[model samples]
Target: MMRAFFNRIFGAKEPEPLPIAFGSIPGMLDEREAAARAMLKEQTRDPEQNIRNGIAQLQLIVNAIAGSEHDPEIHPKLKSIAKNTLPQYIRAMNTAMAKELPNDSEEFYPAAVECVKNCLNSIRGPGRYLQIVFPDEMKASRKGIDTIGREINAITVALGAYRKEMAALSDARSRYAAIISCSEDLAKAAEKNQRSRLRIDEMTGRLKEIGQEMAAMPSDPGMAQFTEMKSSLHQLTVQLEEKTRTYAALSMTASHVLRKAEKIATKQKHNDEIAFLKHAMALLSDHELPSCTELNTALAAACPVVERMIGADEIVLKNKEERAVFAETGRFCIDMVQICSDLHAQEDTCRIAHEALDAHPIHQKTGSLEREKVQLEAMLKKERQSQTELTEWQQKTQERIPVLRDELKNKMEGIIGRTVQYSDVFPESA
Candidate 1:
């Protein structure tokens, strides 16, 4: 009776538990396995597409975190998470994708599955606070969250201001560095100009000396040699004069450029240093507490000092230019003396050559015909020797000219390059 009652209560259709023989349902497990295999095959075949979809989703999360407004209904709870927490979620997602996507086996599948699970969990769990904080339900309590958000916004605004102040300070420092470089370059150029001027003066002095010696040569036995010496001296004097003029022009140009650079440096040192200090003060005030009036006073004080430095630099530049001019004048005089000396030496050589020719027996012969033949032979020999000497001198001069010119050109180019590199004459605005 109890068994019948139990059967009736439970439903006598306690159908004999379906026969549980493995072979009886032959294809059941196999179908399940096949279905799973087919699903896996589909996923494997389009891995690139899956990865692209994942990356797109990641970008969406990143964009939302970066401050994109989202529909509260669509993202529900994500909106309530702290602004900093979104970055953490992104990092976790990236880690999971990296671990999961490369392997075909189940090992990585769990990581991918976990990534999705955790993301959903995060939105439903602690991230629910985000929904409460930023809810679509107008009736939800949001006063506290709004107040905190406002405070954070104010802090961010302050930080932005501080960054601007710091940037100004950096700019000021760069200006100062440029100014200092220009000043140093100007000083060096001034020195070089002075040296060049001095050299020109020395050359001029030597030329004058040569001119005096040439004028003193008399028509004596050695007079022919003196004449040749005079001619050579004249040529050297002309060359020295030309070089002196060129160096003088170069000195002027250098002096001008140097002065300009010095002026620019002075201006920069005066203005930029103060600007840097002001910027630093601004940064300090932003980070700490400082009065605006104090910054204004500091800037005012800096301006006059900068102007004074600029004036001083201008004075220095002027002095340097004058000194260079004076030195070059002196060099011109020295070159004149050198020209005289060179002429004297050339004259002496000519005299020796003439004397040797005169000492030959050809010139002393008494018989007209015999003398003529001897004179002719002597003259021919002298001509041949002269031609050889001239050819040697010409070759040596040609080789020397090109080498010297190239050296001069290279030196000039180096100077120009350095000047451009170190000078702040160019405007920074461009």
Candidate 2:
């Protein structure tokens, strides 16, 4: 039961038996014939059918040695016999059977007989001595026999490749004939493209002539009239722009005076505000009731009056209205200019006072907040240090529990003299 449980946990073990190798002569011949017959069946079905029946028999003899079923130590010797030694004998046999010996080589037939005999010595079967004749051939000339076999194999390969190439050439000729049959259609398309090209050239020439005529034609009378009117409109636009600038400057000056009077009234204390308003009323009275009517009229009037008031700067040609405002009584314009200057100067003083007020509050609050932030950061650093120490202590405690459990399991196993289940000692770890 313990052995079975061990097997269940670690998986079963079994040894593999070796495969058998062929050594009996009858068994070798039987395998050779079977392989040859199988190869012949497939060769007959192939379209090219180039594998000769004689070659298939030779291939079977080669397989008897080169095949993977032999022992490793004997395999190399068997491979040399099948691939090199026997091929020489097979070539001589085939050549003699075909009766293709050279006229000058009388000893070639004797050599063929001797090579066959040597090969038969290795392959003993039912009918071997009768198939090949043992002749009185030179033992020293075996190398020449081997050379002849290699040359024969090369020639056979070349002949097969040549035949395949010939078949491919025949297929290519058929495709060429198919292409020749479509030549008339291709010629017709070429002729159509040529006609389209000629038409396009003719249209292109006509379009060039039309473009020349258009460039030569005179300008229209209506367009000339439009050019003249545009020039006159541009002059009027310049005069209107000048009048607009002059009017804007006059309005800006008047508004500046009113703005100054309003700003002077902005006092920090209630008493200061009352006192400034009283002073403004007294100044308005000093300008007198007559000057007030003129100021009010100029302020409320149209663009032309404002233009006339500004045009008085050039005294060479002034209208009666410009003279009454700028020359006879220039107080309103002078007073407006003075007030604009005073207000511009006061803006700088107000900016400085406002900056001082804004800085006071930020400086007071930031110092207090900065001190509190420093204390909190220091506290956070101390807490993180404590947390790190606690985490390391907990890890060390957890590590020892595993080692203690392992020690207990070892003691129990020694006492019982058998394997201990890990689940019996620590169910959670299991």
Candidate 3:
């Protein structure tokens, strides 16, 4: 009957023990083997089925005690069990129930405990009151189980949202890291470009100085000065070439940095840093390496003209000072010449007076006047010789002035890089 009851409750699919092979033994004691098989079957009890049997027995005992409530001591014992033992049993069951539920499962007992406590408080007079409150306690337990289910579902949903938020935050942090690294690279690149620009400026200044010196050289290349100027120019050209190569490399690097910056700008659209990078890149592109090359090349091409101008300026300055001195000397010579002519006339007068005095020496005593005329004659000869030397010097200088002027005009034309024309030499003069 017990076996039939277990089969009916637990079903045919429940595990069964293997039958004992009593026939395989040669000289088996049938009675002893049957006893051993029975003992083995009795020892192998199913825990769930046993628990069900125990619960059924407890229900039967409670029902029997309730039916025999005329007994006085049984009611107190049942009350003690309700107050302590049942709660402990529920706790043990909850521990077992946790194995089936999630780790973060909600509390199942509070609502049930509260409900039972409230129901028990309402029924205070007698021990039989629990029997009356049992239905309400069961209802509260069911409600508490529903609350646990709902709370578990809610917690599961919230955890999902939290995970998603964490993922988004991680993505944002990654982008920030990329931006920081990219920005640092750009800063280094910009600094490199700035250094290159400074080098280019220094080299350009040196080239310009060389060009100016070359311009100031004599137009004749065979001159010792021109030879030295050409040597200096060669050195400057070498330096400029090196600087140009360095500038080209820097420009390539700048271009690379700009490309990266553009990508960053797209990635971080609406960012202020990207806007600044764009502006700086535009400025770099507009005013950089190629402009330097163009300016230097232009300066080099115009060097010859500048040289001719420099030579012409020197000639004009030197000739101008020379012409002024010649004019003053010529004026002094003219005055001396006039004085010499007057002296010659006085000398003639002195000679004639002397001859006259020789004739009238005896008649008229003019010895002091004759001595004065001899001194005047000697002074007149010296004055005429000095005037003649001054006149020759003045004439030579006056003759060279036109040659100097022509040379100045030729030099000026060379500077103009055209035929000799007044307008060409000085456009403003024209």
Candidate 4:
């Protein structure tokens, strides 16, 4: 009955004792909390030491905000506020450090005591008394104003320099404009001279064309009239050549003269102007006729030479025509200064006849030889056409050959396999 009663009270198998790991008892946790509280009490015991350490920590916080060093102990909630308020705190600290301690005044002693009290109060709470304890916060508040003043000063200096630079640039631009104007004037003068040169070139080309035409005509009685025409053309050519040469020379001289005048006009400095004027006077007084007058005189002198050359050319042309006419007709009817001037004149007529024959187009087919040539060309064309067809057929045959070979190889393999199987079955019978 006693055993049953014990089992009823303690449970039928006495429950296994609850397992407990070492060092997990409630007393151990209570002892740890007590130790932590004692350490905190010890740290806060000396208020003066706490103040010093707090001040040092605050200095570190200020340094971190100022970008001088980092503070690991600063709370996250306070970090942003501390960063913004640190400059003011540092300024206050600096004011306190720089304060002149009053030696003879009782009022100053109370004020100093009150200042310490304010600092202690600030440390205990939200730190609003920090501003009252230190006066340098006013200086720090004016820092941005000081920066603005410095910026304004820098902007004024920069504006003055820029204005001076603008003046210099304007002067440079004026000088550049003068240079461009001078270049444009020079270009215009060059264009004028180039036009004159082109005119001269055209006249030269016309003279050469006339000369060629004169050389190409056949000499006949009708050619005697052309001989007079040729004489006129030769005189025209000589006159043109002389005039063109004169104009070209005059143009060159004029260009030089204009350039010298331009140089004199452009020289504005005193020494440069005096030198240019002296040079101009020397050029003007140089004892030669001006280029235009010299060219005119030269052209006038060439006129008589041109006429004499034309007369000589006319006489030669007339004599050549008369000789040619006589050679062709076997009679000399026209009156000429010389009739038999050249013995080869007859050979020249024969050569001209041969050239005419070579240049003439064929009118009638010549004999059976033409028919044979036509037949031969037709036969050759047919042969070439047959060759082209044969080449195409050969290309097609070559393409088909590879496919046929592949088919033959497959048929041979099947036949060999079937024959081998039949031979295996019939070996004993054979």
Q: List where candidate 2 sits over 4 angstroms from the true fold.
A: 1-55, 62-228, 251-430
Candidate 3 — number of clashing residue pairs? 0
In the range 1-430, model 2's lDDT, one tens digit per residue, is 9999999999877544222221222243345445544553343232112212333344443444233232345446454444454445545444434443232212332443444454444334211221222111222123333443554444345445444443434443333333333343334444554554555455455545545544433254344544444454555555545544453454444343333333433432335433433343333333222233344334333223333434543122234433343342246445543443444344444455444433543333444445655654565455455545545644554455555445534433342334454432222211
lDDT of 4: 0.39
Whole-model lDDT values for every prediction = 0.44, 0.40, 0.41, 0.39
Among all windows of 10 consecutive residues in model 3, the one with the lowest summed lDDT is 421-430
In model 1, the runs with Cα more than 4 Å from the true position are: 1-155, 218-221, 224-430
lDDT of 4 by residue, 347-396 (tens): 34445544443343321112233454455456545655554554565455
Q: Between 2 and 4, whose TM-score is larger?
A: 2
**CA lDDT for candidate 2:** 0.40
Query: Taking the tens digit of each residue's C-alpha lDDT, what string does model 1 give over 142-162?
Result: 232233234334434444444
TM, every model:
0.23, 0.23, 0.19, 0.21
For model 4, state the Cα shift of residue 382 in Å: 54
The TM-score between candidate 1 and the true structure equals 0.23
**Highest lDDT scorer:** 1
Clashes of each: 40, 0, 0, 0
Cα lDDT for residue 104, model 4?
26
Ten-residue stretch with the least lDDT total in model 1: 421-430
Q: Model 3 lDDT vs. the true structure?
A: 0.41
Model 1: how far residue 398 lies from native, Å: 42
